[model samples]
Target: MARRNHTTELGSIACDDLTELGAGKEGWLVDNPNLLTALDTHSLAIANHSVVLVLDWSDGSDPTGPRVKIRPTLSPIESEYISSVEWLVFDDIRVLALGTSCGYLLIYSLRGDLIHKQIVNPGRILKLRVRGTKRDLTEDTSSAEICVVMPGVVARFDGSEIQSMLQRWFQETHSQFWDQKKNPVDSGSSNVRLPYQLWNVNKYGSCADAAITGIMPPPLMELQSSQRYYCAVTIGDDAVISAFRLAWWDFTLC
Candidate 1:
């Protein structure tokens, strides 16, 4: 016979498979094995197989207890085996990203709506990391970025564009014209669709003859300079470390 020991720290909830959550205190965002938790103003996003679940945890009276759940429509192909998930919070809006075992990355809005999906690498994505600061000294500029690591490759997606599309989708979904009929030309236009641009900016093959094991970005302070350069460090299976630098300006122009 097997006995399960369930012990938790003070103020912590003892739930099964409470995997991930963003950093906060006033309200909590959590993901269990089957259910996800979200506050009243915000929705919790979780990926199971290919389905993304968005739950509202605001009861107005008791926030710690289970509240309500919302189901969003997803495409049949989008519901593959999810390998990893992460939340990207921009100001007040939250975006959920799911990485599939088939090397596909799917992005979703806080309302559980699919924002964008793309095949980032030919191999399975081992991990997903969101790098860079949320805001820079230039208020008009965006510094948020998403990093995806595979067997021997590292890919990056522009977070600013993803955020812009989510905001547009959220507004359009809530607007009075969301359900209105539109002309074929207006509905079939490619410009109206959200773009999933995965830039294969860097590779880790030349570092070693072995498979690449890990990839990481340098600290924010190290990358902040007049030239605006970013650096990525990768570890190879041969026990070798290689560093690569990416600059905003072209080297030929300098």
Candidate 2:
């Protein structure tokens, strides 16, 4: 009974400490109802406007500061703030991806190092989504995509671009040389960006959230197996649910 009470007290203390840490400068987490959190195989991440705290995954008691504390440097003139966060996991590594109110995507390493930053849209990004699609089993082919969701727009980013960048980053042996040229902005070819499409889904209704759920062989058409179509879905306060068939020519309201 004594041990149980002691454990309970310790738990309460830890909870209070965590709340304080997550409260940012406001001293109350409730002040920002949109506080972001993400969980993956490695750790749990919590984010305030410009700061991200990563908690180590453990089943045993150990006292240590957060595994990582990433506070993105914001200029005094910038009013952008973090709005969403997600864990981007690859087979060998994972990184934290965050979206901002002013339309930026920031990727950071687990060691709290900023790896990449780019503007995703002109509006607030509501969610940073990572999804995988299996094209075929025997063909041993698959693809992963990142969906940046805004109020009325959903942009699809090819995962291979970011994956290729991280591959070169991890294997680079020359620290000084890579550091000078690592920023994609410095080199246009290695910009970690490729051809991408931003699908408009606001025609049906103002979407609170949206994404390309999946891509499958063109429906109700006798076309080559190489042809694929996107299934775009959205939800909003005005419209409970809406879907569209997206293609090169146009988006079919369905």
Candidate 3:
């Protein structure tokens, strides 16, 4: 009931368990090749369009045990379907983020309450990828970034922006501890505008999916420019697989 990608180290539950998508349902699994879901040690949160469900693996660990379903909070009567989900666990913060068809990021608390929302793109979000890198002894490869991929665009959000905003959000409510049982009284004040980097990557045709794997060191013998360079890998029917060097000016690596 799992699918493994050796190249990206990405593993997904194929189908059969029930609380979420991986419960042996080939039809559902086959239809959702990208899979709108996020899996963590304690639970699996999966979405079908706008409907979201959280399945706790360790029943006793969470009081809302087994199953907790959530419908993203949108403007009254507004319809926005979820395209991707990502779980962020940093320090004492454990929250769920949903990427919507309207290119919005909706962050929710464990209790299934919306905490924050930010517009990321004008197009539907294809996927939300959360990555954290460790500092190597020889190089400064440490960085935490969320890769938000759209059809022909890719954006990145710094981990620090999210970390601080969540911290500030809880503080605004005068609560040092996160309470899963109730919604914060000051929830309205938590809408934060975070700065992000967006790049148009239409060089490889319209990409079905894409992510910035890492910040590469400058090419050998090349002067290190102020701009941080990244390698963008895109998947599409036209190219199957295409690689591009993303800098101030785009460079094709194919």
Q: Could you tally the backbone clashes for each prediction?
A: 1, 0, 9
What is candidate 3's local distance difference test score?
A: 0.72
Q: Which ten residues in a row have the lowest lDDT in candidate 3?
A: 8-17
Minimum summed lDDT over a 10-residue window in model 2 is located at: 7-16
Q: Name the lDDT of candidate 1.
A: 0.52
Better of 2 and 3 by TM-score: 2
Prediction 2 global C-alpha lDDT: 0.71
Model 1 worst lDDT window (10 residues): 206-215
- Candidate 1: lDDT of 146? 73
lDDT of each: 0.52, 0.71, 0.72
Residue 58 displacement (Å), model 1: 6.4
Number of the predicted model whose TM-score against the real structure is largest:
2
lDDT of 2 by residue, 1-254 (tens): 55444432222113334663554365455665756889875467878887787776454635455356777755447687888999987777788888888887788877776777777677889988889977577787766899888988888877877787776666662454555534333322235544456778787767888878887567765656665578888998586788877775463221
- TM-score of each model, paired residue for residue: 0.54, 0.76, 0.75
Error of 1 at 29 (Å): 17
- Top model number, lDDT: 3
Off by over 4 Å in 2: 1-32, 58-62, 75-78, 173-191, 219-225, 248-254
TM-score of 1: 0.54
